[model samples]
Target chain A: MLLQQIINGLTLGATYALIALGYTMVYGIIQLINFAHGDIYMIGAFIGVAAVALFHQNFFLTLATAMLACVVLGVTIERVAYRPLRRAPRLNLLITTIGVSIFLETFMTVLKGPQPTGFPTVLENVTLRVGTLEFSSIQLVILLVSVALMVGLQFIVKYTKIGKAMRAASEDYDTASLMGININRVISFTFAIGSALAAAGGVLVGIYFNSVSPYMGVTAGLKAFVAAVLGGIGNIPGAMLGGLLLGLAEVFGVAAGFSTYKDAIAFTLLIVILLVRPTGLLGRPIQRKV
Target chain B: MEQWLSSVIDPYYQQVLMLVGIYIIAALGLNLITGLCGQLTFGHAAFLSIGAYTAAILTRDFHLPFILSLVLGGLMAALFGILLGIPVLRLTGDYLGIATLGFGEIVRVAFTNMKITGGAIGLAAIPRASNLINVTFFVILAVAAVVLLENSRFGRALKAIREDEIAAEAMGINAMWYKIQAFGIGCFLAGISGGFYAHLLQYLNPNDFGFLKSFEILNFVVLGGLGSIPGTIVGTTVLTLAPEFLRFVQEYRMMIYGLLLVLMMIFRPHGLLGGVNFRRLLRRRKQKATALSS
Candidate 1:
């Protein structure tokens, strides 16, 4: 029973970690929270539902389409909402992001009619068992895909040319520009990649839960954001760790006979972590620019 | 025609006026924090909820007088705002935004789970004490207070901080104290607004005070320009009435609202009024002409 719950916790943690990666990476590079990222995630699920219903495709194809759609959406949001305000006050950019988020959420609510729809049964029904531990095959798939994505992200950030440019731009945009790197491209690419990851996470969640809704992203996005903060806002690896820890906390919080307190526990942990180590578990302490 | 006009238009106009008055009170409080202090709080709705709930409980359960309960509710919200602000005010910019967001969410969830808050079923049918007279009176009082604060020495200090915090501190301003004072005062106004909202709606629910409502209040501030009190009032009135005016676009109301916000940011990023005080603008123009002649 304990093992089953641990597996459940880990599965939940992996989804959060994936979403957290997107939020952390964007914040790390641009120092903007990308409030619209969650809405992009929601759009991805809606697109996934449409793809499956319209194309009559298999799960993998639908997932890919959803991710691709989200990448475009993410880039568009950045170009439209954020790029202009790049030179404006930080507060203006923050407000713009909120506007974009509200726009997307309300748009979806209006279009989708504020109701949740269940995903097709193909992915939802596939379950796998290993001895006494019974688990859905989709859960296993979600875990593997999330781990792979994180590993791939780590490699890209550490080794690739674009990754190197991303790091440079994050460290200092002006310096990166001086070094002949296109700051615009790097920022756009960061948003694109983060959005793609969010889309994938959204699809997985929709499949795992067998339901999708316009407002689902609000709570999930908030939790993932909290995870990002718990791990340290601008630290990628910290976001992953924080996501997992938050997931575990929620799962065990429910398992320990306080199901209703799950969200409260997650927030309490966030406050405690922030108070103890404002920089987070794997984050570098930011000194005041002064 | 005249008899019909009195019966039909008067009640609708009265309701609209009442709503505008209540929103003005709410937006004015937000202006103190976001406009003057330069703190972007995404949790003002939470404070409003606290005030509304407090007043509701006091009136319903404790049998307190309506006016006194309303004041008490505002006080409770201000107390919570101070408590939440103490640890988090040390952080600035986006960190502060996130911390406040979390605090807002915590308040929401707590309200959802608690039995006294009516647990998502919400609190209904207390009393509809916020008629046109009461709303109008409170609105005038709030406007006067905000206008007075804007012209006072303390208000100048707030503007100085908003212009540049480090510079203000260099000029011997007590930065932390001023920020806290602004936050506490903002909460007080937010509480009053919430109290009024409760009486107006005669229904209080946790769902009504979510992040979206916070964003709605924020929309008014941003659309009005940060520090302009009159602009805040105008912005709230226009935005609130826009949907009603465009009732044909009911299905796309939110989408249009979103587009309006985006366009406003792109075109008139300083807001419609751009923080210009009507009276001050006239004076400044006169002063400029005098200087030019001199």
Candidate 2:
């Protein structure tokens, strides 16, 4: 029973980690919490649903379409909404993101209506038994896809030229710009990668839960954001660890019959972790701007 | 006065005014903390909920007088404010925001699960004890107090901290203590506003005070001009009245608000009154008058 719950927790945690990666990366580079990132994730799920329902695409094709579309949408949003306010106060940029989030959610609602759409059964749910433990095939698929994407991300960040630029910009943006790196291109690339990850996470969530809604991103975004903060807001590895721990904690809390407080569990962890280690488990100490 | 108000104006308008006044009071508190103090909080509505619930429970169960319950409710929220403030002292900027957001969610969930707070169904049968006069009196009191605080040595210290925290510390200001005090006072005002809000509705629900409501209050503070009293009032009044004016486009209200927020940030992050600097503007006018006369 415990093992089953742990698998379920890992499946959920994987998606959160995907989303948290976006948050941590954006915060790492620009120092702005992209409130609209969750909405982008929501849009990805809708695209996935549309792909399956309208175009009759298979699972991989649908997931790929969602991710590709999100990359475009994410880049567009940065170019139009965020680029002009590059020199404004961080608070103003934050508010602009909130505004964009609100607009996207409502616009989607207006277009698709407010009901949650059921994800088509692209893959059959088949339970597997190994040594007195039972797990579903969907869990395995989610785990596999998540691992593949995260590994790809790790490679890009560790080895790619743009990844090196990203590291430099996150370290010191002004110096990076002075080093002849195009800051705009780097920021746009960061958004593109983050949005793709979030889209993949969104699709995986849709596949796992078999449901997609316009408002699904609101709570999930918040929790993923918490996950990012828990790992240390700008630390990619920290976000991953934080997401997994949060998932396990929530699953166990439910197992202990505290399902009603499921939402609270993430927030409680957020407050406790923030109070104990404001820099997060893996984050460097913050240098307050003069 | 009640009789006269009723004779002179419709009860509907009076109720609208009451709500506006309550929001003004709430926004004033937010202005003090987020606008003036430069602490970006995302859970202010949580404080309001604490006050509303406390006042509602007191009036419904203890048979306490309306004023007493209202004051006690404010105190309760202020107590929570202080407690929340103590641990988050080391955190600044976005970290503090997320922490407050977490705190807000925790408070909401706690209220949702607690039987005494009526669970998710929320407390009902709250006496409709507060009236327009009560709301008016509190609004006037809150505004007066904030104005006084803004001009005092304490207010100057807060502005100094907002402008340059390191510099403020170098100047011998105790930044930590002042932050907690500002947070306490801000929450206190939100509590009283919640107290009024509860009696006005005579019903309470956990869902009423959500993250969106917090955003709505933030919109008011930002739109009016951060740290500016007239700006806060203008922002609240305009935003409060915007929905009514746009009732024809009810569904588009949120979309428009979202667009406006983005545009406002891009074009005028200082807000409508943020750069107005009323005292300086008035002083310039006075100087012009003297120059013309001479």
Candidate 3:
């Protein structure tokens, strides 16, 4: 029973890690929280559904379509909403993100009426039993895909020249810009990649849950953000650890019969973690320079 | 005369006006924290709920008088504000915002699960104690009190803290105490507004006071102009009344607000009025006109 629950937790945690990567990456590059990232995930789910249900596409095609669409949307939002506020106060930027978040949520609500739509069952649900623990094919697929994606992301960030540029930009924006890096392109590229990951997470979540709604982004986004913060706001690996821990904690909380308070658990843990270690488990403590 | 006035203006308009007044009170309190003190609060609606539930529960189950319940509600909210401030105020910028947001969510979830607070069912049939007269009286009183507070020594200390925390602390100012007090006062007014809100609606649901509501109030302060009292009033009025006027696009109104918030921040982060003190502007204009005539 415990093993089964742990598997369940891992499956849930993998999706959170995917979403958290986008958050951490965005925060790493630009100090903005990218509040709209979660909504991009929501839009990704809708796009995935559209790909399968409307166009009768396969699962990979659907995922690619959603990721591509979110990339466009993410880039546009950055250009239209955020680019102008590049030099504005951090507070203004934060508020703008909230506004953008609300805009996407409401716009989606207007497009698709406020109802939870069932995602197409593109993948078969075949459960495999290992001892007393049973694992579904969908769960296995989600876990495998997420792990592959994270590894791919790590490769892109560490091995590629663009990745080197991204690292330099994140370390110090002004200094990186001074070194002739295309700051604008790098920032846009960051948004694009982060958004694509969120979209991928969204589709996986839709398949796992079998439903998507306009308001789904709000809670999921917050939870993923909590995951990001738990791992330390701007740390990549911390986000993964935080996501898994959060997912396990939530499952255990439900297992302990606090089902209604599941949402509260992430937030409470966030507060506790923040108070105990402002810098997340994997995150290096920031040196405050006078 | 009262009967004639009632006949001329529908009670619906009165209700709208009262709601506007209640929001004005709440926004004013937020203005102090977010606007003047430069603290970013994303869970102010939590304080609103605390006050509303406190007042509603006291009046309904305990059978207390409405005014007494209202006062107690504000005090309770103030107490919670101080409690939240102690640990939370240490964090700055976005972290502080997230912590408050978490606090708000926790409060909301707690309200949803707790049996005494009516759980998901929420408190209903609250006493119809708040009306236009009392709401208006409170609005004026609250505004006057805030204006006075802004000119006082405590207000100067808060302003100093807002400008430069380290500098303010270096200059013999107890920044933490002032921040806590500012938070307490801000929540107190929010509680009072919530008291009025509960009584006005005569129904209290935890969902009604959430992060969205907090954001709405924050928008009022931002749209008006940070640190400008009159600007908050103007911002709240324009935002609240514009919706009623554009009732045709009522569904799209929130969408418009979302777009406007982004655009407003991008185009004019200082706000619509650019954080200008209107009273000072008018006096300066008058002096210029006099000098030109001479």
Which candidate leads in DockQ? 2
Off by over 4 Å in 3: A54-57, A286-290, B1-5, B278-282, B285-289
Sort order, lDDT high to low? 2, 3, 1
CAPRI accuracy category, model 3: medium
Q: Model 1, range B1-294, lDDT digits (tens) per residue?
A: 435644766877777777888888889999999888888788889999999999888887888888898889889988998888888777777667777877787888899899998987999887877777777888899888888988888888888887878888999999888888888888988898898889888898898998778878877887888788878988899888877786798878777777777767777777778667857878999999999999
Tell me what TM-score chain B of candidate 1 gets against the true chain B: 0.91
**Candidate 2 chain B worst ten-residue window by lDDT:** B272-281
Q: How close to the true structure is residue A91 of candidate 2, measured as C-alpha lDDT? A: 76
| Order of candidate numbers by DockQ, starting with the best | 2, 3, 1
Docking quality (DockQ) for each candidate: 0.54, 0.74, 0.69
RMSD of 1: 3.0
Q: Write the per-residue lDDT of candidate 2 for residues B67-186, one digit (tens) a residue.
A: 999999999999999999988856888889899988888898899999999999988889987678888888889988988899899999999888989899999999999999999999
Provide the overall lDDT of each model, using Cα atoms, as 2-decimal numbers.
Answer: 0.83, 0.90, 0.88
Residue B81 in model 3: shift from native, Å? 0.8
Q: Where is model 1 chain B poorest over a 10-residue stretch in terms of lDDT?
A: B1-10
What is the fnat value (0 to 1) for candidate 3? 0.60
lDDT of 3 by residue, A156-234 (tens): 8899988888999989999999999999999899899988999999999999999999989988998999999999888
Lowest lDDT block of 10, candidate 3 chain A: A281-290
How far is B282's C-alpha from truth in model 3 (Å)? Answer: 6.1
TM-score of chain B of 2: 0.94
